[model samples]
Target: MSHPHPELSSPPPLGKGALRVVALGGLGEIGRNMTVFEYGGRLLIVDCGVLFPEEEQPGVDLILPDFDHIRDRLDDIEAIVLTHGHEDHIGGVPFLLRERPDIPLVGSKLTLALITAKLGEHRIKPETVLVEEGQRQDFGPFDLEFFSVNHSIPDALAVGIRTPGGSVLHTGDFKMDQLPLDGRLTDLAGFSRFGDEGVDLLLSDSTNAEQPGFVVSERDLNEDIEKVFRTADKRIVVACFASHVHRVQQVIDAASQHGRKIAFVGRSMVRNMNIARDLGYLSIPGDTIIDVKQLDKMRPNEAVLICTGSQGEPMSALSRMASRDHQIRIEEGDTILLASSLIPGNENSVNRVINGLTRWGANIVHKGNALVHVSGHASAGELLYILNMVRPRNFMPVHGEWRHMRAHAELAKKTGVSDDRIVIAEDGVVVDVYKNRAKIVGAVQAGYVYVDGSSVGDVTDAALKDRRILGEEGFISVVLAVDSNTGKILGEPEIHTRGAGLKPDAFDDVIDKLQDALDKAASDGVNDPHQLRQLVRRNAGRWVNETYRRRPMIIPVLVEV
Candidate 1:
């Protein structure tokens, strides 16, 4: 029940025979998941991922977990265990690898394949150890075991760590879907075995902890998808996460049943599907998927286009089509299905895309209008079941917002876990488990490291604030010529504005005031060009704020002749 405070000091040296856990990201937010486990001076990392940019983070490509905590200690790392292949779990691997390229990567076959493909783009040949649901490996002081878990994507795993300090089980984003499309059920029996062996610490997913009941099975969406295929008289377009193999399988099945050809749009969609198919995780019928270029050759009713942008990313294929900027135009009578749940911060963007598509006379179906999507995380009931089953000495809820984590902590209390035994921590908070108990020790630097185009960690908050001001308020520039020796005004100052919501003649009112201010500063012996520039900025800014009530960015340029 401890929360982070501004006065929390840096954690003390790791106690002898103790395991210290720190989450660099994915505690208070839903994305950029990473956790560092320290034992006997060695580090084991789990799930390095990235977060998508929100509306306020303009021009940001991605957000990464701050690696400063381990930047200098990279050589002490044993390995990085990837629990799944989702972007929020594995997206930051390549960036981390750039610091230390030889760290062994451990994950399932499909997960490894996805990351390998991604790393290939970075021109990095990684050293990886391929594992599966039932396997065990030892890395320095950490002994790892893997268990099968059902999720939106195939080959998801939950990891178990055994150390001299204690035994910890991390359920990396799982749900109890009894009738999963891939025939893989969450290993409840395996969890019971871990309980029998005594689980000192249990970290579970909390993304859906607020929901009241079990999550609807992925199989349940088949009937609704079939209905969409049967009723659509024109072309059908389905948008989902590029990594959702099961959803794509459902779309492929429905399209095949209705005798329609399918095409994969978006580069990520094509690449991920190709990897899944090659690894035997995705099954596509012969000639079922054709190139996107051939989409126009078939009749309207005979084609199904599956693409990305279920969350309405600006550059995604579905968003481009909605804006009429792509090759596939949204014509009348077109049926579009958004097959993925919306991420928390993407609601406005998704709504904008939906409005754009609706304006073109296309019918839209989504989680709100129809049961076209189901959550990939377990709900309250399933969490209660796991809490009762594992019966661990300490519990930590990961992979959710604060409210979701708080709700999950309450569920743990109801299942006989004491309030003191539950640790509700945010990103960068450090928790140490020893002698079968866990407590908060201190905190670390876990701020957002923005990724702009071809740049990482270079964009600062002050820069973003200036960009916001320019975008929202506007910009104004003032140029003046000055006499260096006499410290007198040479001529009238020139002013111009952009995006300031003012007319050209608006500068005429401020020019005289600026000249007078410059002359007064010069008479007072302020001959420095920098000082003159500051005077001009102050004078012009005051006039604008007083006259127009707008706080636009004002730049002053002074020339000394």
Candidate 2:
């Protein structure tokens, strides 16, 4: 395992004129995988993406990388390079386009197809350049080469970027699949070719660094899906990731084998399936695909429904059906298959949906129950293989949590990479690689920008904390009217509470005590609105905490007429 180098023990202060690398996101965390490569005042961005919300981020729909660092240097941005079409890798492209339009996007045919569809939804028309494997392009001071890589999604690539300072090879979310569904294997020879030339810095994916051994192939998972189709008696409903085109293809093949028509039940699933089929990445038999509305037209045993919400997202089509809120409800003896990996931190929510479905007598079949899902990331052994192949002078792990990144660094060391050659970084930490030396240099403003509804970067930490408090303890509002001339209380104080863990009748005695306190304060000539509000909040809050053992948000209102 690689340890921190003694000479590079601490992050150095920013120096003038060096090759700078900044991770806007996808370091020390998962999702929102973005990085900025700077050379000679020119910027090249790789993978502007978004992160899904956790339980802590209440009311947040999505999270994006803060664009403050690049907002002023928009003109210097040469192009945006996309490695794949996953939401975490391409979801934020529209947001970036909103900031600076006319920047050309470069990626594989299918990757650009998915991104173009996404941009159309946001009413954006971007200049797109489609490239295949072995293609090379020059943008300003940067020269980029694309190579094929096998992942859960089709047309995924690993990028090789050449700049004046050094060269970086970014393995964008890949696994070594020996037998991929499309018979297209990862370009091992291409990775070796880059290795022969000597890479300066390698920013690799660390998503599955902690997992042991190599990942199972998508071909293995396809056979399992076929087995389930042969055994199932009734209609089959599968919940999977919408962007995983390979898994979707397997499901379509399985459905056709069982002589069933397929119906996509989610917005993303429907849209992506159409895009994949149109681009030749997905194959469907003639009239094998049908609309959701036509599901009733076919017999129960002749239909297969592939939807989203394997993670138990509330708004997903599977969740709606599980909760009996969708047009089609789960029936007795129906088979519900979850053909997706259970992402960390989503176990409880996924289990809740499973419980709901089982209560309606549906049989639950998931990755735990069957060999239906395989990860799209390289495991420890595969990471070691890549490290040995690339043999980069300096290494920085990306696209995983801190633990994953650290584990990847350890794997690199096992492959003969020295501690001094490994550079583990957090989000926004800048690492400068020169012709001979590389070290972490200073930091930048790389924070999460929350997206709620139509608003982006508007939700703050304080607001989310307040929402959590309200959810846990509730709130109280105290309304009082003051006499304008007499400086006296007009009437008894009105106390209203909601979700404060207290009933209306229970607050009667508390309200009486508060009214008396208000009258006493008024008699003492405390007619100032601010003073009265403070008095009410302090006394009412203290009394409530003492009596109920819980502190609710106390809001005091003073009105004079």
**TM-score leader:** 1
lDDT of each model, Cα atoms only? Answer: 0.92, 0.87
What are the runs in model 2 whose C-alpha is more than 4 Å off? 1-17, 484-488, 516-525
Over 211-248, each residue of candidate 1 has an lDDT whose tens digit, in order, gives 99999999999999999999999999999999999999
Q: What CA RMSD would you report for each candidate?
A: 1.9, 3.3
lDDT of 2: 0.87
lDDT of 2 by residue, 1-561 (tens): 011233433345434556788888898777889999898889999999999898888899999988987899999999999999999999999999998879999999998999999999999999998989899999998999999999989899999988777888999999998988888778889998998888999989999999999999877887778988888788899999988888888888888877899998899999998999898998989889888899878777898999999999989998899899999888888889999998888988899999999999888888887899999999999888898888888888999998999999999888887899899887777799887467886677778899999998889888888888888888999988887777677888788888887877777777788888887886787778888889889988988989889988998987786
lDDT of 1: 0.92
Q: In model 1, what lDDT does residue 95 have?
A: 95
